[model samples]
Target: MIYIQLFFSFLKIGLFSVGGGYAAIPLIQSEIVNGHGWLSMQEFTNLITISSMTPGPVAINSATFVGLRIAGLPGAVTATLGSIFPAVILVSLLSLIYRKYKGTTAIDTVLGCLRPAVVALITAAGLSLSQTALWGELPVSLSSVDWTNALLFLGAFFILRKWKWNPILVMCLCGAGGLISFLTGKFF
Candidate 1:
């Protein structure tokens, strides 16, 4: 049941999401939040945050998270494989077309169109995560955001731009912050 749903949902996303994993965020969010009702808006936000700080593409990480939540390890594998299958097949086939269309205007136009859409999807993911992280019942606004988060975000941005920091380190820091925040809220 859940496995089948996960497969179908991610397969659709994998098949139609043209720009890659980030571009699939909106579709994944809609399916998880609206179509299946597997996760609440807040949960989806947390899932995006967690996924971004993990080692894989957001779409697959998201599918894995939702699948694990719904049915456990088996569900995770099923969802991940489903999400990957279409990309694997498509890319393999595209190799056959590359020789014919590598420098064509059609490919150029498609690439140009996809760039802005990818930016929009990434921005939407950030906005969703920000809304969930802040704006709890406390009535705080952006100016009242946690200073630690602000500092971390700024530091990460600066470091990423000025130097070649390993992405794994950035992910580790974010994951640590999420764990600390979650634990403090849970036990303290």
Candidate 2:
């Protein structure tokens, strides 16, 4: 029963995610955190962090991790399949349709409209993650804010913008800085 739920939940995420994995974060949060009560917001935030750090899309990574936590290997398989099924089917269909309507204005207009929507989805996901990443919750209150994390974020932003450093290097440096801060009892 849990396996079925997991599969269907991820299937829903896959079907309507639209605009890739980052865009799916809100849906994933809604389904797992709000709808299903499977994971806490903190756990979901951690999942997003882990998903981002690892290979592959965040949605698929999240599905695999959450499934493994819920019901082990078989659950992971089912959840992953569910998460990818819609994309596979839709892309296959779209490819054929796009080929048929190679020069149609309607299709072009549809794609143009979707671009802004995708941007909005990605932006919303980023803002949502920022709340968790910086404050660890929704309806962010100043009292709960982590000053260390906020400082690191500002520093990272500054260096990235000013020096135009490689993102991977910046990430590594930030990770090291976080570890050092934690070890030195600087981060609270």
Best by TM-score: 2
For model 2, state the Cα shift of residue 150 in Å.
0.6
Q: How good is model 1 by TM-score? A: 0.77
lDDT of 1 by residue, 1-188 (tens): 87898888888878877777767777887888879899887788778778877788888898888888988999989888888999999999988887779899998898789899888877886666565555532466766566556656666778788996997797687668767867786211
Estimated TM-score for each candidate: 0.77, 0.93
Q: How many backbone clashes does candidate 2 have?
A: 0
- Per-residue error for 2 in candidate 1, Å, reads 2.3
Which 10-residue window in model 2 sums to the lowest lDDT? 131-140
Query: What is the model-wide C-alpha lDDT for candidate 2?
Result: 0.91
Summed backbone clashes in each candidate are 0, 0
Score candidate 1 by lDDT: 0.78
Top candidate by lDDT: 2
Off by over 4 Å in 2: none
